[model samples]
Target: MRDLLGRPADTATLSVTDVDAVLGEVAATTGSGSASRRSELLSDLLSRATAGEQDFLLRLLTGELRQGALEGVMIEAIASATDVPADLVRRAVMFSGDLATTAAAAAAGGQEALLAFGLELGRPVRPMLASPADSLDQAVDGIAEPIVEYKMDGARIQVHRDGDEVHVYTRTLREITRHAAELADLVRGLPCTSVVLDGETLALTDDGRPRPFQETMARFGSTREEQVRALLLRPYFFDCLHLDGTDLLDVPLRSRREALHRVAGEHVIPGEMAPADAAALLESSLDAGHEGVMVKDPDTPYAAGRRGRAWLKVKPSHTLDLVVLAAEWGHGRRTGYLSNLHLGARDPDGGEPIMVGKTFKGLTDELLAWQTRRFPELERGSDDWTVHLRPELVVEIELDGAQTSTRYPGGVALRFARVVRYRPDKDPAEADTIEDVRAMLRG
Candidate 1:
């Protein structure tokens, strides 16, 4: 792990293409073992290995490691080792299982195969980063830099496709493939012989308005995939990392967008033309009741697993009343209050509340005590201070839209999530919907 994640813990100092080189090297060295043999042997060894799993894994291969090894960094390394671009590596890790497979393909088959693998997942792995977009004036000042369109409230979806197979992973990279078949079918129809796309799926309400992002999430939680088809969820394509037989990352965002448009066609996210006047697009997206536009520099292509100014999502921020369904034990001063709360939205069709995100801030002492005494009631079971609840109550929580998660049940998770109030009068059915959450994306 040290070899993979050690250097320049400061992401600012790292090159966008570094990780891809590392992955290419490792995959090339894995030899010509069969996938089944590799899986069996690795799984067994992993089951018995004693050196902190990640540590041993990295030692077996030549790469860096660190305690909070950011996914983006590892992704870069994998792409580097495989001679593939960061985007393809990012997509593979995000939507598929076993990084070794991606590495092997990139090593032996090269970037085109990696692109094909990433596109196999229903939605391409989304490349995300903490937004660095400046205000409208700041954005306008950099007009010569070139920018692309981006929507606000949609869920960040990673689609992977392989031959006839498709999978939709949430932000956490969990396989919610079986749960989202309608979307799978839609993505399967893309014109590309093989492709992987990075984008968002927004929900439109019955009134023709975008709904909260939570509504879209609920649909993701449903075992019933068709629920979203009826709800009118529209996928807004933003970036393409893998094309028919090439990696777009080596190209520019302009090229990637062109490829994205060709494959997605009518399904391509609807947006205005450019040299897109940033001010005009800003006004257009916001005034349309959409969140805001993402301004992607046309000259830059996808920087897989890295967050740079290459793409910027813009929108006025908004919050919502989400529920607190689970509580994780706190650390330090919050050691006893159960600081980090696992939040959920009401399930309209009678399923467990789907997890949205976690927050340790925003709880009053009274509310914390209430939670301490009351939260256990919803527990399916408990382990020490932590309690896993049935996720029934509706708490008025708020936050920016969704992102991926590593520790949540539903694949996608939220950002800057906090509590505003509890909804005593509202039942789970009356609470926020996935569409509402998607609308927040545009905020």
Candidate 2:
């Protein structure tokens, strides 16, 4: 081991069972009252692991798998290995609500056991996500019909109700029920005994207008109930995943929406179906002080945990393709994420990418996971503040404009920059140059 990896191995042997034992220890110790005892147990496990094994275990422990295979690849592998249909495997995994357990069952009990997995109450399924559309017309162009709704800028929430017990979950499936008892009461009063609702929740003014995103997030994310009492959250239901003892996962959006209207009544999101003109609707939505509009295909099923083209979100903003130079460590809910990104523009003279600004906005947990897994692969080095990476990945950022600044050598800084998406297909060379940004300053 020393000869191959240039690192001395303290342990002579390791096994899969040993790793599992260590995991059990860590899980048990994490909840213990003694901090010193937890640290001692963790340190002991680290000492027992070999260098290579340590790296693998750390990745697994932190949920930062850089092996290039996420759930999609795992499902494909399970299908190939077990001689089961890939679609069936996917459905089973989705229904079972977990990959690890579903794969084990498929491997152990074969198809018979795999077929048993189905939707159950109180167990949260992942929510469907949207892809960004450049314009409202572009969003409605391809679809046979589109449901256009005002896209509120707020927290994505999934509310699950079974009798008197109500659970509210964030987009990441973190249960925040205690912090939102009032919301639970609102849901309890809804016209259903059992239901699952997908929607957005945010602080609204007394006139029923939506507040700023930050103010909403502040109330939604606060641990102190009294501190956030002044800023109350209102929910707007957009989709129904289940209702009245029936599963709606395999049904079309139109059917689910019908159920949503029946169950949520006045709480159903405001929208128009197959409008004669989408541009007018977009203008109205913007004029009504919404972020923009969401254009959804009525024929598509609810694809949990998948970001597909069935739902399109159109936000009005100018975007630029820039390169990621470095990232800083995150905190709180963003603890393990590469939260803050150092953005740079392409040098017109073919030199190194030039730094222009920094941003930590518009990031979802899924995107943060992608960054945590991929950034280390492109790592050049690291200092105390940031993890420097190779300028190989391009990211699209939306900003108000650029301004002259002494902060960066590029002579300008992005005003209120936020990420739109990562551009995997584009190379760093093709990124917008400093000159293009300066042009924005002049414009």
Candidate 3:
């Protein structure tokens, strides 16, 4: 930033037009031999910028502008400004996959324009997400008619097929059709001429057990055909959003399941319609080396981009009594507290605690205030961002599982770890050992 600032130019103010011009020039130099020219343009813009303008420009360039205008807020704003219903605007955004386009439609043609934004071929729609359930019983009981399916620990994929031309997208709507040619071929071979499917895909072992998540991610990230062929991804589709010429987004889960079964056939994920069968499916999913089951309400429509009670994910979490080795200062709402904790496992050989993972989840405001006051009292040393503790404070952590990691001395790290509660009654010596953490990876 210092180098970019260089020397200030004699400019009173910088306009949006000036910044847009510089950005346009930078983007235009993408295919040309203009490295020095692009740098010169950026430097000039920075030199002409005021302190506030420079900060805004840097944040915009780095995609860190944290203005409170989230999607929901924007949707409401668009509806109020255009005199359209907020629900209509939100649905348009979800189907169109772009807020700007939805806003333009609302402004240009109002309700009629927004209503026309239906599911489009080759365009990905936002995925429906599930809320975390405490237990299978709770998930089953909460729904009127529950449909249980295995929740695979893999990358979420949205596949669209328009005849032989198939497109595959990640959960974020980024198209990876070229990299996932095999997936495209698989979708193309389906019976439907035009279809949209949402599912999870992962690599499998020789015995058909799912591979580690990292291995599945490697294939998704790679463009090499050899690597993609070697670690072929197997997709287990759970929902069919559009089948043939009909859109199923507004349809109930039961009807959607029928469409999915007819189209995806054997690729349809194993599921049962009865709430009584949820327990058996969960046990079978776990025994098959998969994650727990997703309990879904069979009567609810597919609510894209919503984490409502229509779908609930239940996983058998593993808890471990771990030690807090250090903590970093929080940000935003937790600004003054030592929010993020560096967790460690006890070493059985009388050595220092082995650093495993860190977490800031499940901490209530009361706990945050208590940690801010208590962690400093046990502080042995300090740094700019973290306060090192004396390894005497034991915290109970609940996690999904453990994965192999090279970042820590223990060679394993906790996954989806959150604070269950502080084990103030337990001693650090009685904490879980590093060997016990490694056993999760082996299991």
Candidate 4:
């Protein structure tokens, strides 16, 4: 193996398992450890690995595998590998909450194993998502009747409770229980035992109106008790995924919503059967300080992790809310400030945001100062010219239009993109999708 790299063979061949073991050891080491120690550890592992193993290990460690395979690709691969129906496999993943585990079970135990997958208490099932609707009428165009609920701009939360023990997860499946003890306490007081709830959590002002999205995020991201105590969150559960040993994932939205009402009581999100006027309901939601209304079909089963037309989100503007991926250093009077912002659209397949365009317009001196101060805090890595961020901040962008572009990962670029405002209330998950941006190209 070493001969291929023009190096003399020095050690025995290493199996894939051996490489994994080394990676585990490296991952366990603290960042505070000496650089020499890390180098020595890697050297030892490399000495025992074959050339092919060494090459693969380096790429894995450097995150340059570039396999170009995402969950969607894996689902297709699993379907092909296990001879299982693709939709069945997708549905299993939706329930099981892990594609890798579902694929393994399907390969080992076949269709029965896939069918056996169900909602488990304390495991967060992916929240069902909504597709964007251009207008209220477009949203309710086909369905006989739909339920329109206020789409509050806030964090997506999935609360799982079994008896006295409770766990809270974000839409991305990150456990935030330690940070949301107040929310857990509220869940504990619920009527049912062993339940899974899907909801939105946000802070409210003293007058009982929703607070600014930034204030909600400050409390959501806080780890200190004082910070959390200062801003108590209220969870408005919209759907019940599981309750009292019964899984409601495959059940119609109407039944699940009934379960939500029974479990969450008054805390359930406010909604009514297609009100006499969908437009009025949308305006009411907006006037009540919400982003929009989610018009959902009651008979449709929850399609977790998938955005479908069964549920439609109606908002006022056609603007895309994107994440700030990176920013270049400013020039002239704006010197030392991070000026040109690199914007990206959310990938629908649950991957990193795809870079769409760069914009330097629509900035006031105040915004520039804020970006200069905040960009450093969100920095992932940086070169002399630009600073890359963690893709945590979502910004609303007003674009002249989008055009086909081979330069961007989404195969499209924004024309004359300008920042509308920073969306402190929305997560990257709620950002406008690549499909949403591309759809604008044709219009």
Best by lDDT: 3
- The residue ranges of model 2 lying beyond 4 angstroms of the native Cα positions read 1-7, 10-18, 21-50, 58-68, 223-226, 320-396, 399-443
Q: Give TM-scores for every candidate, taking all chains together and pairing residue i with residue i.
A: 0.52, 0.69, 0.86, 0.66
Candidate 3 accuracy as TM-score = 0.86
User: Highest TM-score: which candidate?
Assistant: 3
- Model 4 TM-score? 0.66
Q: Which is superior by lDDT, 2 or 4?
A: 4
lDDT of 2: 0.82
lDDT of 4 by residue, 56-107 (tens): 6666666755444778889989999999998888888887788888988999
Per-residue lDDT over 1-443 for candidate 2, one digit per residue giving the tens place of the 0 to 100 score: 12123343677576777767766775777454756665566566666777867666566666764564778889899989988887778878766667888888888887888888877777777678888877777888888889998887778888999999999988877788877777899999998999999999878777777766656667656887676777878888999988989989789999999999999998887788898877787888777667778999999998765547799988778689999999988854577778799999999999999999999899888999999998999999997767999999999999856667779999888878999999989999999999988886521
Candidate 4, pairs of clashing residues: none
Clashes of each: 79, 0, 0, 0
Q: Is candidate 1 or candidate 3 better by lDDT?
A: 3
Report the candidate with higher TM-score, 2 versus 3: 3
Give a tens-digit lDDT track for model 3, residues 1-443. 44676655556578888788889889888656588878888998998887767767777787766554778889899999999999899889889889999998999999999999989999999888899988888888856678999988889999999888899999999998877777898999999899999999989888899888878878867977778778988999999999999999998889999999999999988788884667889999989888899989989887666657799999987999999999999865577889999999999998999999999999999999999999989999998889999999999999989888889988888999999999989999999999999888723
